[model samples]
Target: MVKVTYEIVPHDGGWAYKLGDVYSETFASHDEALEAVRIVVQEQQVGDEPVEISYQDESGKWREEYSDGGDRPEVEIIDRFRPGEASV
Candidate 1:
């Protein structure tokens, strides 16, 4: 996991993140931040699954079934993953 710092800024009508990639979100408040992170992580995780599932067909042939319920996963609090670093 790559560590990154996100900047939260006041946008046109609300708070936004200057660096939200596939793993982070920006907010004006702690509550909003928490919610956004939760949602982003869940959504991403559901989007990262392999698209095709293969299995043996009737003729012993491999068949593929499309998987539609997976998503890419994201990480939060990069510092949490720092080596030899403890977060309190």
Candidate 2:
């Protein structure tokens, strides 16, 4: 199964969670960021019927394929910050 990681980090004078090179909206506090990630995690676990999908990959090629909605990737969150440590 594919494993996806969301990492919390400092962004734009606030906090945000990022997957790969993409980031969510910045939050005013780390707790808010954590809450947002939790909500997304819950949503990602819901399953549906298999369906056809299409997308352009990094190589700039458009591809189409069928995806088993139940084949969702294992998702995780990584927060490097400790209570009193500097933010990353």
Best by lDDT: 2
For residues 1-88, write the lDDT of model 1, one tens digit per residue: 3343444345545544445643233455644654564454455555454577889988999888886654333344322323442211
lDDT score for residue 56 of model 2: 100
In candidate 2, list every pair of residues with a backbone clash.
none
Per-residue error for 42 in candidate 2, Å, reads 1.0
Candidate 1 versus the native: TM-score? 0.33
Misplaced by over 4 Å in model 2 are: 54-64, 83-88
- Cα lDDT tens digits, model 2, 1-88, are 9888898889999999999999999999988998898889888889989999999999999999998888877887888864542222
Overall lDDT per candidate, in order of appearance: 0.48, 0.85
- Could you tell me how far off, in angstroms, the CA of residue 2 lies in candidate 2 after the best superposition? 1.1
- List residue ranges in candidate 1 displaced over 4 A: 1-26, 48-74, 78-88
